[model samples]
Target: MFRVLIAVGLLAWTGLSRTATGADATDAQGEVDSARRDALLSQAQDCELRNDYADAERLLRKAAKFPADERVSAEILVRRGDCFMKRGKEHRAYELYKKAIEQYSLYIPFEGVVERLRAVAERFASGEASWFGVKERDMAIEIYELIIAKASSAKQAPADTLRLAQLQTEGDQKLEAVQTYRDLMKRYPKAPEVPEARLDLARLLLDLAKGGDGDGALARQAQHELDLYLQAFPDHSRRAEAETWEAVANERQANALYRLGEFYLRPSHSSVGAARRYLHDVVREYPSAMSADLAKITLARLDQKGIQEPEEAGQPQAAPVAAGVGHAAVVPPPIRPPDKDLTPEKAAPPRPAKTLQAADQVEKWLLPLEDLSEDTGEKAK
Candidate 1:
């Protein structure tokens, strides 16, 4: 038993000794690295003062390679970046700053690091041409992304998020831009950038929905987003443009509805009610859409087939009162084919000059709706 206890004590002592020796070796190596790093940094500083940034950067890069000195490595990167900045090498400085941020441990960079990153990002984002009308848009995107990712708590982070999205768009990274724009709004709901992002996103989605081969889902999304913009920023400076986009969204949706109605009306589907429902909705909900006239003509064909009008089509929308505003509301009679023996000229209601002018206006509006019957018989075939 005594022999066993002595053996265990020796084992413990040996373990302790080995641990102390390992610690001492680590300390010794750290001192060696620190000394080398300091020498490199001193030489880099001297080169910087002599306006030899090329050499200063070289020395700083060597200092950054020393092991077990993450703090100094990060410092080295910052110093190299400063040298580049002093020499007006913003792109190179941005690269070094990015590395410094990644290597950050005990060495916190000055606030200027984030500011410098933003300046570099904006350089490309602002469309500043390079020597040959070239700009590093992708680099700008990276810098902005780095700023947002590394310095998210910075006051300009939200703005950087917006700029990143814009740069992504310029770089033809639409899907990525979409996600970034969404992040901007979702992450900073109350930010001033939200409204602009919302509007721009809506426009981009709408553009995607263009062309017959485009995705209908994009159109639907645009409609919803535009609706939100209209409701949220009624008095916004860009309200008119938003309204125009909303109209386009409505037109796209109406076309979707019309096509869906056509699908239901096909012989294989033969869903009369669904056809009528979608067509009527297009005509009622989106009358200003170009497809509304198509819907009306198609509806007439269904009527001619002896299919009774759907209960929902009972109320015909009111026609315009006149060419000008401020006129009292007046629902014109249903548009029917003009009688061969009767002309609109003869059917004009006789009244005062004002009434006659109003009749002329209603007849003008009625002409287009009346002409649908002329095309209906031909189109139905």
Candidate 2:
């Protein structure tokens, strides 16, 4: 028992000593560490030139002491990462590079390191950066957050913010993803990626509504966003798709209103005027929506005080609306009453000068088919 206690005490003391040494090395022995780190870095470079990466990495590890010049310390970390990467220890290389960004040195390969980290993030997200056959996408999320927060790669921030939100969504952290999406729009409203972010945000809101938006609030938000985006980007190539989403939002709202109206009409909660008004709200606000048609059919029954007949099977149902565009109503031809007049008549009298000329010019031809033409005519008259 005594020996075990002594062994535990010694182990604790050794751990504390190591921690203290690391803490005080920066200030108490700064000069000594600086000289030693520099020499080791030099030797590491010589080994690198000889393509002796195994030895180079060993020297770099020893050279990674506290409080060297920021540039030298950063270089040591990055060089180690490079060696590990060449040795196919990408996971280790990725960790080293991630740490190197925190040194805050201008000489650090900020752009190159950021790009490499970004690539690693993608590999992690795609399940390609696995040691035991599965990669955690949380690593990708952390890397993106670091890049954005550190501004180590400011140019990539907007796009990365969007990607981070998408990954969050896939991970089922939808609410956090929503905030991140909003952050992208607020922080970089003028970015080229903003439009896509806006579209996605609205779409995500609608998706959330599908879960449990009893009052259709999320659907309304989606509708408003789509409205503003469409106005701003009238000539956008995705305008049609955006319009479709807008229509879906509208129909969702109409559905809620319709249900509310139906609820009011139940025998337990009868309110005819309220129900009528709600149904009318749908027809007036969303005439192009499919629910508006339902509202209209329901309203007709309410007004007539009788059950509206079901649609005939032979009657053509409404065609599936085209992106929810408004359709013009076709008017039927009016009936015309038949005329009552219906008769026909009238013979004309012969002309006297023509008859006399015919008799004078052609006495023989003008003679009647019987013996006397003029005499027969006089007898007939």
Candidate 3:
């Protein structure tokens, strides 16, 4: 019994000693981790204050190397990436953000790592730039392209395509932008972006029309796109803009048609039939639109010969008039000019207007006008 008691005591003492040693080891590790973390944080803060992003990044990398908790390690990687970005090392920053995403993916409880990744992605989307002159425009395009390619093989977000289209438009890559928008309509017909895309597309088309693309073609295109936009997003935030653009496009098309009709009576009538077709379209299809109202006024002017036809065939008729004669004949309409209320000084914007407004937009375009038939008795009403 004495021997058995001695053995039991020895075993208990050994067990207790082992437990103490284990606790000491754990406490030592905790202290080391805490010290390392504190040192890294201090170094980073110092580097940032001194504007030494390189040193800050180096310290962050060392902190990431420590076999600390996974959370701490991931956080260090993110901090390192942020420092890299601050230093204009976008490629390096992207790599670190990618690393953080991967590491967090392994232990994080979120549905996917996209939210964390998106934190960085949003900077690109919001148009941030790196010190290296790498703008978010480039990154956003790359990400959008990647998402589009991926969606083909997986459940890609429709929002990705929309973002790409928006970036392209903002970057002045119009044809590609429109194509991508069309792709969104085809691929994710039900996506929320589809309606917004349509609205944006319509506005772009109207701009094209006013910029002097074929008025007939542009008017048709704008009307079609605007109809689609209105159908899809009648109450969208930009609905008023869409409506206004739609009206402007139609008005332009009508003016083109009326001008063409007047040209038909000219001795040098070139494209008279085309002008009539345009006028007919304005009167028939856009009956309730401002263009139609202008069309009615034009038809009456032509009928009254307030715009007399150019003498035909040199047969004892009046001498040929100048090209602007027709335009001069018609009384200026009552439409309010955009800046009519402002004085010259007040009308001047901080910068010269690089873009055209609804009223003055047609000045730059060169679309063909239709010839008028000298006898259509329509009124402005």
Cα-based TM-score, every candidate: 0.59, 0.64, 0.52
Error of 1 at 199 (Å): 1.7
Q: Candidate 3: worst 10 consecutive residues by lDDT?
A: 324-333
Query: Cα deviation in Å at residue 230, candidate 2?
Result: 0.6
Instruction: State the C-alpha lDDT per candidate.
Output: 0.77, 0.78, 0.66
RMSD of each: 23.7, 24.1, 27.5
In order of lDDT, best first, we have: 2, 1, 3
Q: Write candidate 2's Cα lDDT for 1-381 as tens digits.
A: 999999999999999999998988856677787788788889999999998888999999988754666777788888998888767566798889888887654779788888877887887888777767476678888888877887724888898899999988888788998899899888888988777888888899999999998556688778878988898888878889999899888888888878877876776655555566678888999899888899888888776886432343453323322333222211212334976554544344456664455446766655456654345665788
TM-score of 3: 0.52
Better of 1 and 2 by lDDT: 2
**Model 3 bad stretches (over 4 Å):** 1-56, 59-91, 98-127, 130-136, 147-156, 233-238, 270-280, 288-290, 306-381
- In terms of lDDT, the best-performing candidate is 2
Candidate 2 Cα lDDT to native: 0.78
Best by TM-score: 2
